[model samples]
Target: MRDDIVTIEPDEGLRTWGWVSYLLHLVVAVAAVLPGAQVSIALLVVALVIDLVKKGDAANTWQASHFSWRIRSVVWAGVLYLLTSWLWLLFIIPGWIAWGLISIWFLYRIVKGMMRMNAGLSVETA
Candidate 1:
C-alpha cells in the first residue's frame, strides 16, 4: 500500500487570541467571587468585544465553539443577575446569596472553557 500522510496545521494566532480572551474572562470571574475585590467591568467588556470581533475569524474551526461558549456564559450570567436584583430590595442576604451563586457558576464555566481550549478540543463537546 502506498503511504500518503496529510498533516493539518493549527492556527497559532487564533489560539493566542483565545488564550487572551480566556485569561481576561478568568480574571473577571475570579474577582466576581471575591469580597471587596471587584475588578473593572471594562475588562469584561474588552474580552466580550474581542470574542465578538474574532468569532467570525474562527468560524468553521474548533475555536469557534469557545467564542460562543464565553459569550453565552456572560449573557446568561447578566440575565441571572438582573432577574435576581429584586432580591436586594427584599433582603440584603438573599441578594448576596443569589449573586454569589451566579458568580461561582460564571467562574466554573470560564474554567471549564479554558480547560477544553487548552486540550485543543471544542467547548461544545463538553
Candidate 2:
C-alpha cells in the first residue's frame, strides 16, 4: 500500500488584492442596502477596475474564478438596477423594494466570494 499527500499553494499577492477588492465591494453593497447611507459609487468602480486589471494575472490559477465572480456580480447587479429603474419613476414603494432586494443580493455575492477566497477555494462562475 502507498500513501500520498497533495498540497495546493495560493498566490498571496493575488489574494491580497482580492481581499482589498472584496472589502471595497462589501462597503458599497452594505451602503446600498442601508437607508440614507449612500457611499460613493467610485469605490465600486475602483474595485471593478482592480479586478479587471488583475484578472489576467490570476489566469490559469484558482484565484481567476474570484475575479470573474466579482466582475459578473457587479455587471448583473448593475443591469438589474438599470432594468428596474422604471419602478422608481412610476412608484416609490416598489422601487424601494426592488432596489433593496438587489442590494442584498449584491451583498451576498461579495461576502460569498470573500469567504471562498479566504478558504483558498475557487468561486463557482456558473
Candidate 3:
C-alpha cells in the first residue's frame, strides 16, 4: 500500500510529470464543481500527497531563477494545502460544500518551465 506513494526526489523538489499534472487538476476542478465532490476530493488528496511527499529546495526545478512565478509556487503550494484540507472536511459530510477557490499559484507551474529557460538556472542557484 505504501508503494502507492511516489516521491521522485527524496530531498529535492517537484518532479517532472510533463503537462499531465495540469490535465489531472482540470479534472479535479470539474469534479469539485459537480454535485458529488468525491472525485475532486480524491484528486485533491492525491495532489496534496504528491506535494507533501516531494522533498527538495523550493528554489530549484529551473523555476526559481525567474522573478516571475517561482515566488508564486510557494504561495500556490500553501493554498493547495488549505484547499485540500477544506475539501477533506467537505467530503466527510454530504450537505457541506466547498466554494471553488482557484489557487492563483498554479500559473507559476506552466510559467515555471519557461522561466527555467529564460533564467538559465534552477531554483537552487537562482
Clashing residue pairs, candidate 2? Answer: none
TM-score order, best first, reads 1, 2, 3
lDDT of 3 by residue, 21-99 (tens): 3345545545554565455356545544444333233223332233233334435655665656666665744223223
* 1 or 2, greater by TM-score: 1
> Candidate 1 residues 50-98, lDDT tens each?
9999998887777888999999999999999999999999999999999
TM-score of 3: 0.35
Candidate 1 off by > 4 Å: 1-10
**Deviation in angstroms for 37 in model 2?**
0.7
- Alpha-carbon deviation at 1 in model 1, angstroms: 29
Candidate 3 lDDT score at position 32:
51
lDDT of 2 by residue, 1-126 (tens): 112212335568888998999999999999999899989999999999999999988877778788999999999999999999999999989999999999999999999998888777777732
Model 3: residues with Cα > 4 Å off, grouped in runs: 1-15, 18-20, 34-40, 55-59, 63-126
Candidate RMSDs in Å, in order, are 5.2, 4.8, 11.1
In candidate 2, position 4 carries an lDDT of 29
